[model samples]
Target: MTLRLAGGIDVGSCTTKSVIVDDGGNILGSHVLYSGTDFEGASDIAWRETLSLAGVSSTDSICVFSTGYGRNSVSFATNSLTEISCHARGCLHYFSGPMTIVDIGGQDNKIIKLDQKGLRVSFKMNRKCAAGTGAFLEEMALRLRLPLEKLNDLAKQADGEVTLGSYCTVFSGTEVLEKIKSGAALDHIVRGLFHSVVKRILEMDTFTDTVVMTGGVIEHNPFLIDLLKTHIQNDIVTPPHPQIMGALGAALYALQEAPHNMD
Candidate 1:
């Protein structure tokens, strides 16, 4: 019997992710790339790379779904979904039972509450400011004159004693500079920044016992997970590919919808 494949593309504000899966819900291939200024171009590249890794061609009969900020830009999508729904479904793919999802993305952050049956109970999002998003971290890294990739390691080396008083990104940047001028330890400052991120998420909403985090920020700086765990004092988890959970969820949706499309 021939195998059926399904594809999902998530065009986020800062990154685009693509995933291909088999009928049995197993991932075959996935790819991630910067979204840049062209959402369509990024989606095409991500989709092509994912297909190549899956050893499939563009002509294959795969159901395609898209989600995220640029979901509407995916001209090839069979359908598009809201990022909230996709994130909830994607996180639930790995973890069962009622849970909370914290997705920290480039431009914004989301907190989704799910009931025992996997239905969305409610959600909160922060889009008015960059305080708790990846953009905030990048700006902080720029102010610190450190590479963005070094944040995780530097944070891990800290004593975790430092705490930033400001939650606004601009104010936090000024605060970081003040700490530098005061001869504060660099590692401590980094950890403090991570602390701010966790604090921001905590203020977003109350979480359930099981909290699953997903998105590019978590994928890169996993130490934030440890920080969050300490604060929430609850079970926390992340999927295998945190950055691609939206795309993976989209693919899972495709798998379910594919049968209806059969000739």
Candidate 2:
């Protein structure tokens, strides 16, 4: 059997994602891995792992595109694209209507707005601090002596909401400790942390019609979407493969933009 494949690698600050797609844009295989400090290694592992999952080798690849913070480090990629362009492109694949994209990633967050015609109208990002990103949750989890993955479940235990006032990661950590000392329920505090993340992102920019959530954070803590829906009146949407959207978009780029004759 012969295979026509396009691949994408996204090396984010916290985690890396890769996706393989057929000519029809169907996802054949995908992989997600911790990025750690070595972007090159993350890129390598993501590509190989996805290819492995697809039961193919590099020889089957038509082209590989790269995105995210470490897009330039993916040595085997035919080309590279930015996370903003890639996310917008990727999210549009799911809902091609007017939508605002909220991507919560490892070290930063981005709000990308696309019009009904699939053109970017405006965008905003938070990279100055770890206040609203995945790092914030990781730090809060550490201070609470809980695994980051447990935050969603913990937040579900709270009946009443707690609003965390501090957006600074350091101060928030201190605040969480103070809350614990004051005998606040761990679950309420956890929900408050989730609220703070959504609050910080909402404060970044004004959103439009349909709101879409993407990225690793959204994938792990789905409760964040429930919390977010409470803030916005518009219906919310999440792509099927939230964590690998950038990589999928990159693969789509490869399929569309890459030379058909290229190997």
Candidate 3:
């Protein structure tokens, strides 16, 4: 029997994601893995797991597309697309109308503005600092001796307002410890961390209205949606699985490539 299957693999700084879809644009399987050493090897591991989850074999698959930071290194992909283009296509697949995409991954964050048809109009990225990225949060979590999820949950419980004073992780970590030494409430410090991340994103402050958030951080901290909502001045939207949006977008692009196959 022949199977018309298309796959997409996303290799990010912290994690790898793969998505497989049938001709009808239905997800057959998906997997997430860590990116270590060469991305080519990592993509293979991620794709193998995804195939296992879908209960399929290499012989049953068709074209594969790759996206994300390491797309160029995916030897098996028929083609590669930039993460920004893939993300726009993916978000447009899930929702329509004016959209602004905010993706906070392990090493960086991006603000992408899309038009009504899901076309990217403009975008800004922050790769220079860790303050707005997951790396920053992970370091802060280590300092606080709290699981990252617990940090966000703790932030949700804050009774008093607090602000983190530094954009640099080292300075912020020092200040955070000082606060703890002074008997400051744990929730206050947690809230301050979330606030600092939001503040850093606001520094880009380029897009407006219909903000849609996607990334692993949101997966761990759903309360970030509310915290972000408080800071933004426009409508907000998020998909059911924002963390997988990049991979999903890549799959969506595969579908678009063969519309006749997409039922």
Q: Which is the leading candidate under lDDT?
A: 1
Q: Candidate 3 lDDT, tens digit per residue, 1-263?
A: 35577888888888888988887667788888778868999998888888889888763346777998899888888778878877777787678858889988888888899887677789888857777788888998999889877887798989875677887999999999899988899889888888888888888856565999998887777777888888778887888778778887888777666434342
Report each candidate's C-alpha RMSD, comma-separated, in the order given. Answer: 1.5, 1.7, 2.3
> Estimated TM-score per prediction?
0.96, 0.96, 0.92
Backbone clashes per model, in order? 0, 0, 0
Candidate 2 pairs with clashing backbones: none
What tens-digit string does per-residue lDDT give for candidate 1 at 1-263? Answer: 56778889999999999999988889999999999999999999999999899988753578999999999999899999988988988888899869999999999899999999999999989958879899999999999899999999999988754779887999999898888999999999999999999899989899876989999999999999999878777789989989999999999998898764344
Taking all chains together, the TM-score of candidate 2 against the true structure is 0.96
Candidate 3: stretches off by over 4 Å: 1-3, 258-263
Clashes of 1: 0
List the candidate numbers ranked by TM-score, top first: 1, 2, 3
- After aligning candidate 2 to the native by TM-score, how far in Å is the CA of 145 from where it should be? 0.7
Q: What TM-score would you give candidate 3 relative to the actual structure?
A: 0.92
Flag regions of model 1 displaced more than 4 Å.
260-263
Score each candidate by Cα lDDT. Answer: 0.90, 0.88, 0.81
Clashing pairs in 1: none
